[model samples]
Structures are given as C-alpha cells and as structure tokens.
Target chain A: MNITVNWGLLAPILAIQLILMVTALTSLYKADATRGPKWMWVLIIVFGQILGPIIYFVVGRNDRS
Target chain B: MRQFGLFYRKEMLEMARSYKWIWVPMVFLLLGVMQPVTTYYMPEILKHAGNMPAGTIITMPTPTAGEVLAQTLNQFGTIGVLVLVLSMMGIVSGERQSGVTSLIFTKPVSFIAYMTAKWASMLTLTAAAFACGYAGACYYTIQLIGSLDVGTVIQAGLMYMLWFVFVISVLLLISAWLPNSAGVAFTTMAFIMLLSFGTSLLSRYLSWSPSRLSTIASEILTKVETLSSVGPVLWISLCSILICVMLAVYRMQSQESISAKA
Candidate 1:
C-alpha cells in the first residue's frame, strides 16, 4: 500500500481551512464579547477543522456588543 | 438613495468588523472545493479505512464535471443556505430587540430606504460568497473530473443565484417581522424546507415554484432541460423576491410601533 499522496489535489482544501482558521482567530481576538468563554472558542477554532471555525464565526460572537 | 448608500456602507463596515466578509466566503469556498476533492479521493479513503473484506472491488464510475458542479450546488442549497440564514438571522430582529431600531427610527430615516439598504447588502454578501464557492467548485471539478462549458456554468450559476436571492429575501422578511433571531432563523429554514419538499411532492401543480430554481439550474448544467422551461419559474421567483422585499419594508414599518411600545 504505497499510494503516494497528491499534494496538488489537496492544496485547495488546506488553503481554505487555513483561511477559515485564521479568520476565526482574528475575529475571536477582536471580539469584545463572545457567547461563551474565549478560551473555548480558541480551542474550537484551532481544532475544529472547517466546521469549528464556522460555528465560532456564526454563533460564537455576541454581536450586540 | 443617498441614505441607502450611507446605510449600505454601514452594513458593509459591520460585516467586515464582524468577520462575516472573510468567513462566509471562506466557508463557501471550502464547501465548494470539498465535493470534488472528496469525490476524487473516495476510493483511497475507503481503502485506507481497512475495514472492508479482502478483494472488495470498488468500481464507482467517475461523475461528469456537470454532475460534480450540480452536486456542489446541492451542497450550497442545504448547508450553504443554513450558513447564510444563521449568519443573517439577527440583522433586523436583533437590532429591534436590542433597541437599535428605536434609536435609528428616532432620526429621519425612511423605512423603505432602510429596508432596501438591508436587501442590497444581503444580496451583495450572498452573491459574493456564492460566486467564490461556485468558482472554487468549478476549478476543482474541471481539474479532477472533466471540462464544462463556461456559458452553461454561468447560466446555471445565475439561476441558482436567483434561488439564493429568494432565500435571503425570505430571511430578511422573517427577520423584519419576527421579534427574535432564533424565530427568524427557524421560520425561514422551515419555509425553505417545506417549499422545496412541497414542490417535489406536487411537481405537476407547483412547477412554477421558486424551489424549482435549484432543480432547473442543475438541469441546465446537465443539459437535460432547456432554458425555455425555466422561464416561467424564474419569473415567478423574481416576483417572489420583489414581494418579499415589499413585505419586509411593510413589516419593518409596523415593527416600529412595537418598538415604540418597548
């Protein structure tokens, strides 16, 4: 089972994930308030792949502030 | 019009500050590219799982580029719609609930202008996010699957975008009418799901339903349906969007008195 991985094919997915992560982190840092603890969101954004960052961006921020 | 411009600028600024501009398009781009990449890697993915019986031959036919693009649209139709709705659910109701609407209304703001500004910003955000998603999907599909006609993709994309606009308009109207963001999101999602399900169940009777926009868009890409067949439904959807905008304005005006009470 020596199938070589195609980095070319996987690059876009990685790039998108990186963008989502960075955006989530940036927003979390700037957010005056969040739905829950800031530390929890930081963990989610760092570990949650595509969905983690999205959830934080969508519902985590307390937009009222 | 000047007021609309100022309000739109404010909306855009808010979007930027909230990171909606960055994350929404990124999510769409991710959703777009995932379909083709996953489809391309399914065989490898299955093999690596190592749970299959020995000599389990997987002979899945590769899907055509058109099929892949259509599949991407299906992803957009479901999860993409959910993201858009959730992100925007609080646009009107949140403001109203938090007393921002009352503050704004105390000024010489035109309700119609305010609503139109909101509609414009929603359209801009949805359109840009969708374009990014579709473009990402197209790039991956063409690279991995096969080539597609650019004209066909544009036509299909336009049709699908109309459906998206309809969905956003519904959200805006619900947000304007409802008192809570959760209610706005839930009602909009329910209406969308019910409309699509009902159209499918009653296809013959509801051929002109806005829900058919998604199907027609995919059909255009698949080359199974002509554009002429889509005309009536497209017109119906455009009218529906117009009605939604008008209703949102009317609802917002009425909400003013309620906000006054609060």
Candidate 2:
C-alpha cells in the first residue's frame, strides 16, 4: 500500500479540530456552572472529536444570566 | 440612542460571558469548512468504508467551487439556522420567564432601545459569524475544487445575510410575543420551514416572498439569477423585518399585563 496523505490538504482540518478542542476545554475550565457534571463534559470534550466540543459549547454550559 | 448603546454593550457582554462569542462563529466556521473538505475526500472516504466490489471504480464529477459554496450555504440553511434558533430562542422570552424583564422595565428604559439593542446585537453576531464561515468556505472551495467569482460570492452572501436578518427578527418577535422559550423556538422554526417550503411550491405566485431570498442567494452564486431580479423580494423582506421589530416592541410593552395574568 503506497497511499500518500498530503499534509498540506490535512493541516487545516487538524488545526480547526485543535482550535475547537482547546476552546471547549478552556470554557469547561472556566465555567462557573454547566448543565450537567463537569467531569462528564471533560470526558465528552476529550473524546467526542469534532462534534463533542461543539455540543459542549452549545448545550453544556448553563448561561442563566 | 444612548440607552440603545448601553443595552447593546450589555448584550455584547452577556454574549461574551456566556462563551457565545467564542462558539457561535466557530461552529459556523466549522460548518463552512466541512463541506469542501468532505467533498474533496469523498472518494477516499468511501474506499476506506470498505463495501466496494473487487473491481468497482468510482467516478464522481468534482463539483465546481460555486456548487461547493452553495452546498455550504445549504448546510447553513438547515443546521446552522437550527443552531442560531436554539441559541437565541431565549433572548427575550427566557428573560421574561426569569423575571429579568420586570426588573429592567422598572428602570427608566426605552422599550425601543431595548428591542433595537437586542436586534443590533443579533445582527452583529449573525453578520460576523456568516462572514467568517463564508470566507472559510470560499477559501477551501478555491483551493480544492475550482475558482469562483468573488463578486458573485459577496453578492450572494449579502443576500443570504439579509434573509438571516429577517429570520432573526422573526425569532425576536416570537420570543417577545410568546412566554415559553420552547414554544418560541418551535413556532419560529415551523414558520421558517413553511415559508421556504411553501414559496418553493408556489413560486409563480410567491415570487416576492422573503423565503425566496434563500433561493435567490443560491441562484446568484450559481450565476443562474441576478440581483436586479431579487429587488422586490429584498424590499419585502426588509419591510417585514421592520414590521417584526415594531410588533416585537409593542408586544414587549404589553408584556407586563400578560405576565401578570400568567
């Protein structure tokens, strides 16, 4: 198997994923409260790939104020 | 105007504090970029999924840059709009339900200022996020698929943004008029879906409908339609937004009595 994965093509996708992950983690770290348990969110953020961070950001935090 | 400024700033701060500033645009950006990337990789993705016959060859026509961008807008039209609705459904009704509106109303606040401030912040968020998402999609489309005319993209984007403004205004109006946030979201979604679907079904009669704005936007991108043809629809949409705001302000003003009865 001589499959060549172009780094140039894949770099932006990786970068976007990284940004999402970091943002989710940072928000989780600083959040005063969330919709559910913080540890569950941490696990979801770590393992959920592209959608995990987005779900965390969208539905996890309880923005009551 | 000063009151509007103060309220707008407060709204911005609330958005920032709630991490809406960070996440909303990021989600849009993700949605925008995903279309082109996934389209470019579809063949390889299918191969990896491993249900292909031994000698089957997949030959798919690579979509034009314009088509890829249109697909991105389609993503926005569905999932992106859903996210915006879910996030913003509580902007007015939720506050009312929580008694925050009562506290704010007791102060010497202009109802117009309050409504306009909410409108302005929603517009800013939508515009900024849409611009980021569309730009990202354009960049990836050009790199992976083909070239598209910048002017066409901008015109289509502006048209789409106008449709978004109209939708958000409808949401704000519903949120103000309804006491339940879930009810507000559902009604807004149903209204939007009906508008789009209904107009498409009766295009000849409803050519001037605001829902046609989405179709006009896509047609502009694909070079199948021109801006001049969309003038009536655009004007109607703008007028509808203005009407929505006025109705929202009126509803908010009467909210005191409504809440008292509730």
Query: Pick by TM-score: which candidate is best?
Result: 1
TM-score of 1: 0.96
Q: Write the per-residue lDDT of candidate 1 for residues B75-156, one digit (tens) a residue.
A: 9999999999988888898787778889999997999989999989989999999999999999999988889999999999
Deviation in Å, model 2, residue B183 alpha carbon = 2.6
Q: Write the per-residue lDDT of candidate 2 for residues B85-172, one digit (tens) a residue.
A: 8778888976777778888877878999999999999989988889889999999899889989989999889989998999999999
Q: Each model's C-alpha lDDT?
A: 0.90, 0.86
What docking grade does candidate 2 earn?
A: acceptable
Give fnat for candidate 2.
0.28
Judged by whole-model lDDT over C-alpha atoms, candidate 1 comes out at 0.90
Q: Candidate 1 - CAPRI tier? A: medium
DockQ, each predicted model:
0.73, 0.45
Of the candidates shown, which would achieve the greatest lDDT relative to the real structure? 1
